[model samples]
Target chain A: MKHLLSINDLGADGINEVCRLADLFTEVSQRPIPKVPALRGKTVAMLFYEDSTRTRLSFEVAARRLSADVMGFSVSSSSVNKGESVRDTVNTISAMGPDALVVRHRSAGVPHQVTGWTSAGVINAGDGWHEHPTQALLDCYTIRDRLGSVAGRRIVILGDIKHSRVARSCVMAFTSLGAKVTLVAPPTLLPPAVDSWPVDVSFSLDAVLSDCDVVYGLRVQHERQAEALLPSLREYTAQWGLTVDRAARLPVGALVMHPGPVNRGVEIAPEVLDQPNATLNEQVRHGVAVRMAVLYLLLAADPDLHPEGEAS
Target chain B: MSTVIKGGLVIDQTGERTADVVVDDGRIVAVGTDLSGDEILDASGCVVAPGFVDLHAHLRQPGAEEAETIETGSWAAIRGGFSAVVAMPNTNPPIDCAAVVQEVLALGAKAPCDVYTSGAITVERKGAQLAPMAEMAELGVRLFTDDGNGVQEAGLMRRAMEYAAGLGVILAQHCEVDSLAAGGHMHEGEWSSRLGIPGVPAEAEELMVMRDIALSRFTGAPVHFQHLSTRGSIAMVRAARQAGVAVTAEAATHHFTLTDEDCASYDPVFKVNPPLRPADDRDAVREGLADGAVDAIATDHAPHTMDAKERPFDQAPPGMLGLETALALALTELNLPVAEVVGLLSWRPAAIAGLKGVHGGPIVPDAPANLCVFDPQETWTVDPHDTASRSRNNPYAERTVRGRVRHTIVGGQTVLVDQVMRP
Candidate 1:
């Protein structure tokens, strides 16, 4: 567990191990004094080249909870805008002797590139259209919390599978955990070679609604409409959105999940988030704990120190 | 001053022979037994052949000197056994006008290797207005292209082809439809899907190749395809040539040697414009070279600084150091005869760049003394730091490659001896 760059890096066992460790962190997150000395004296740096709110804040909370010092480099305020290359920024930050770097960039492989530039462990907060491993781990934890186990569950990831890092990560994480993932999107919104993925594909949300154990709604980026990936968000919503009607079609206790900063009445109806089975809030809550587990695993806990740490 | 290249099996357009070639006044004066001259260049255990001619090279001179200058790129070319290299016009102030073309030629005048340049098909390569091809052609610019960007509008390309046909110059296209290739950082395939990078579909290249073939037929002008990577594009070119559409194609060394799978490491060094494709496409390119469908093997040797390549995959500029590695890669990766590989790298590309009688050799009396001496079986690993080009974005760095240049002669000058460039 040198870095959590991709969900694919974590196999079925690694996924389960993360979920289990996240369970321990979730318990600690509930305690009145949640701070732990597990990562004390260690430092974690945030290099978010892209604008991120939830992911950055979640990681900050998680690092603080584990008692690790946190340093941040926002692109807008930093030397990045002064024409400093990603390599220079990473090298400069790495010189400060951080144990791990949490990187988010608008390019798919920036985190992977950062790994080469720095000796520190790397956690991909989110890279462009690529995997958001922590988000996926947290999603796995949220699902396991609700359904008790991910195995044998039917998970339908809906909308914008082409550009959503969340959907890419979730599909890998859920499918790795033995949950069958069905990706539902307009043919244009789906990735060009999604057929190679270990998942079923559907065009209509209505068709797959009754069969799913979990409906993972991906945010339909409105900018894609301008790119002509979709005709309009209204059309995307009418076709693939987890609307009030579509949510009603799910069998009793079927979960609705969305990685946050959701556009209301776009990928989902306004009332859908209010549903009891909706796990958007839970996904956010689990994001912090999952990140705490990841930071602990990368920065604090030694593999030999863990009771049954499988060689990754 | 006369020089004798001794103990080499000379392979040229006229075929192979064990000959001691004597050069004086920039022309071969003798090709016979025990030739004596003022200077001796030992070519023992070497295949002395016509020096390779690269139809595509980005010397990055006139601008972007931080990446490559004419002197450095030409020296790299000499090291790679290329006596001549055509500079692509994608520099900062692109080689579009007569003055720019003249400036590039003058700058390359003192280079160890011959540096010819391609004039831009459009002004500044913006693809909107036609460049002064005739004026640039008068300065010996033989090939014209908007290399980094394909001329997108069909009508504009048709007009450019008509103009090039009249000017008696060939228009080489980079063969990408910008609308189709928009925002794509690599080849669109299962690998790209897995990597989550936006993809440029093979159709983006094929569509333009298809369009140019039609335009060539319509205008009755010859169109040359640059760095044809996709299998479909090769098939189209093969068919169009069979149909006598006057289309010639060249494959870059990397297209046949590396694939899109190389981009999995997320190292931007592997990121190229026509982006490395799948093994199937790479094999197709190889087959195209083996057959007569592909005419030449050019080093689309674009150079970029380390800082530029250090950016993320999508943000990093696409190119790799190629002038230093083309011949070795062709010899190591392609399962073709040495002569055929030489033809692909030398005579064939020389013909495409309109350097027929001047460069590609017959190794007889009065032929230009441009020759390369190489041990085809010698192996050397590529080291980016050891190269003469001002960039280190070599994807083949650390890759063991066969066929090293032993000696290179340009215009009767021994520019490289015993694998070292003359100071």
Candidate 2:
């Protein structure tokens, strides 16, 4: 794929290929040196237009581990703060010849727009309520590592599916991997056209919790709550929050995941983060390896660099 | 100086006839079998009709001249077989009062097409207080609208309707409830869910359409619905018409020709206000047009600069250039007879825009000679870069469409002849 902007951009076979490549990177991550010379001379730029701590740090670590040079564009200090247009900013950074441009913008399709302006392999880190392909990939990697496979798995993505790019991408990735995905959120938290999605949707989280092989909690965007999308944080936590009782109801050995800077007691119980089944920390770790796979596949998969022949 | 448009089947509200039209001193002096003038413009095997009139278009003048000025928009309108267009009241400073209306009218005086200005229904389109309807109406502004946004307050909209009724002016609405349509970039449907773009539910538009229909009934004033994009909105309009409500509606060319699925590419060009809807909604728009439930195919010709349009689909302003492609798209996409198509583009919209005597015509003598000659069978691909407007946001670029405007005569002056603008 020219760009990892959406999970839908990768079909079942393409997703499987990415997972297989990520397996090799996962092995590299466990090594004593934990470094690879695959992307030795390449450079990757991380353009974060939105405030991000985990995603930004994970991508920077991934690039460095691959021995690739990294350039980070901070929205606060860059020309973006001076009202520079996305095109102007992309062009300015593109002139430096970064092989892959990992962009995270508050707008849905900024990564797609960047693709048109630059030759750099564009990666959608996390755009506004749109797909975050790398997050989905890491989630898939975590799921496969624990459960052996995602196919036929009952995956329930819970919480604010409407505002969660993670939910959108995970639904797409999981469904492509043959998982039967169910989206659980309040009617308002679900997108208006959720019925048309590949996954079935449910509002009652407790009813589906026991049947799920994976209970993925999406962050309830508190910013949207000010618009009265929700009644209040208390009501939301009461209804959709993955509390201790809900976590205990999950099928034995079923994984519980969250794409964090978790709201603690809002989308998930504060105690749930410390649970043995909670893969939130593992998701962050897998994020590095999966992103390393993506960068290597996109930037350094030339025939000369791939001495063992291509992954395909 | 005079021009003769010869050897074409002249079709107008009065019907079709083989005629040669002669124009002089900004009026059609003769239209008969063998009329002749000092200049002859060939129109063989073409449908010669009154130039089209758009009830809604954003000329973006006074403040947003970077996207479109009256001169450039007029050229685009003429190239699309339009002799007149009602410039929407949603410009930068907005045409909310007599001064802005007068300024737009003055700019239109030098344009190729007759540019009529619509005043805002609410002051500055804020939906709080009524604009100076009397002053604007006195300046010959027949239509008032808070277009780009609907006047959200029911009381204010009612007051504006009553005031407009008293002034003998029509109020047009852009029909979207802000609360429901907020943060939405495309119609809420299958594509929107899959693409994960925030969706504007059809009900957001339907609720306002329902409100306006009731408002029209209560106030006994005519309301023109702009760019009705949903099945529910069209069905409501159809039912309202059946109930004898004094409401007229126009659908944009994109509403009937495109759908929300086009937003799959996440291209902001397909992103428009009332956003492209589902397939059923698209079909309903077409059905509304063919069955006369809809009055005119108005081009909501909104022009945004390339830089503005290049933003991500959600952040980008909603609009697309339509003045240069509306007629061709109508001809290519709608399954209607050429005569009915001409009526939608010509007399029907001309009447709606209150440009009857000056624009849409019977093509008879002394009719001011606003006419268009087009080959209905001819086909051409749209190139956005070839547009006359200052912006390049045409969604129909690379689309091969049948029918083309060959010549346009506005006020007896040959503005466009053989697809070339007259200097």
Candidate 3:
């Protein structure tokens, strides 16, 4: 409860509570003022060791709308470029007294390590090929909004499960919410230990599309192609891409989703990204509300911040 | 000065007897019931055996002194009941030449225990060119390794093995194909998938084991597999040994005591090369030890500074301190006879490291008096802060372990008396 490092860290009740708070924030976003005092006087610092415009912007907007001060640490221009160790960097930032730290690093478990260095609540934005809990939360919220409930839903996560932190988080979040997830990817693209995952896995994407209520396509990095994990991008699209034909084959009212910066004509067709059923934009919009809910819950629950007498 | 270790059950390669061992001028002069000497060290209700020999240990010296030095590592060895340890050659500016080897040997001269240096199989351990094996061999370097990394190039490894064959020395491999283990911080298993940490598949190590076995067969040379962790690796080593492949292997203590599940906390202290495997692999390692498929229980006693290990699990370097905990863990975890435990810790590894005459013993007259006395039933918890090594990255901290070294004698001198280092 102190940190949102992974979806596994939150059980079903915790996930539902965040979704409920996010619903309230979604209503707040529609208001004329579009702001809340839930996190008034609190400070949230985004310490990004990786370059991420969308996640950084989402967290910044979320904190600002909750009336919490925000600070951004750019890895490229900051002391990180001077070869400062993670401990020293976190200690220096923590000395400035932020109520919480949102970290995104290229190495998995960086946020977990930061938790040991500082007493502030730590939220994992993204870590290398690891869990991205907030993204999974926003995705789950978007799913609940569309489908009424996540229970009994059949979600198919497609493509590059090995390198996709989003896929890893979604599998845990969806499974914990009583949904059955089937991951579809090339054997090489799937993780080495995917056989032990909570979800069932398949190689052919078309075979499972009919039973799926949600088709989630993960971004494929062109850089990884050099490692030759896959034969080629052309081969990847022919088999796994959510092309126009494949999207049309989905069950009526089923949702199509992607954690964005989509690889058009690669993981998904360009037209699929703009379809009415596509929830990528909604995922982005809900990111802020979910992050706001997380910050509110973490800071408002702190005894030092709210105090027992002033909680109301 | 002469010393008498009395009233202890003496167990060694020759078997057990209740005798007082007398030592003078660095050799055992007598072994009898009513023996006396210039000094008497009490060893009642204890087992006296030859001090353990560690075939693998990273004594970071002549570089990275912040983590470990020869003197501090030697103290740790003696405390762990080790009278002799083979210093791995993976230090910065590695022990590839006669100069570095001689420098480490000179450093070991002042240490509490004997420190033998292994020369690098490749120049600078880069896996490209062969190091000056002939020169290092002349200086008494018996083992060669590019440890902390496997020689990735097969051609280079074969050539090194052939040259090692020519020199009549042994080549030890860390056994990981870098391409398969790249970007991996832990073993590929259920826990890795759940935790989302990139993993090194068991095949990464198996492939190298397979390659080296082929290389050894082709070159007719001896190959020593270091820290064998996976079940497949153990099975293959066992079959190869049965097939007369002239291959010897050593498993580290952590390989059996811990697993990939320990990585669920994402602590770098548990992150090691050929990273901790699953329970089946751990069972296989134990089986290998029990059935003589594995020759020695080596402590890959790697020491890393707190700052280096403070990074995230994936970014942090791999390794942990082992010299101070190897025997205790073996006694606590392995369901084997006391004499067999001594064999794994002392004679077996001593033979592998080629220190037979000087180290591992029968405890008979005229043998070098390198011995350890330990109570196999005593229990103690590990504290990282209370260590002789310069580093504080001990993974066994807070773990309660049975058995403890009571005294250690090296070259007839009681280096560790009653569990405290002597000045």
- TM-score for the A chain of candidate 1: 0.96
Which regions in candidate 2 have their CA more than 4 angstroms from the true location?
Answer: A303-312
Sorted on DockQ, best first, the list reads 1, 3, 2
True contacts kept of each: 0.82, 0.66, 0.70
Clashing pairs in 1: none
Writing each residue's lDDT as its tens digit, candidate 1 over B1-423 gives 999999898998788889899999999999988999999999888898998899999999887998889999999999989999999999879999998888899999989999899999999999999998999988898999999999999999999999999989999999998888998999999999989999999999999999999999998999999999999999999999999899999999999999999999999899998999999999999999999999999989998988898878988899988877887899999989998998998899999999998787878899898999999898998888998888899998789999889899999999999989995
Candidate 1: regions farther than 4 A off: A304-312
lDDT tens digits, residue span A189-227, model 1 = 899888889999998888889998999888877799899
* lDDT score of residue A130 within candidate 1: 88
In model 2, what are the clashing residue pairs, if there are any?
Answer: none
Q: How far off is each candidate at the interface, as Cα RMSD in Å?
A: 0.7, 1.4, 1.2
Q: What are the per-model DockQ values?
A: 0.84, 0.67, 0.67
lDDT of 3 by residue, B1-423 (tens): 899999999999999999999999999999999899999999898999999999999999989899999999999999999999999998877999999999999999999999999999999999988999999999999999999889999999989999998988999999999988998889988888777788899999999999999989888999999999999999999999999999999999999899999988788999999899999999999999999999999999989999889988887899999998998899988989989999999999888888988999989999999999999889999999988999988999899999899999999999998899995
Sort by lDDT, top down from the best? 3, 1, 2
| Cα lDDT over the full model 1 | 0.90
Which CAPRI quality tier does the interface of model 2 achieve? Answer: medium
- For candidate 1, what is the DockQ-based docking class? high
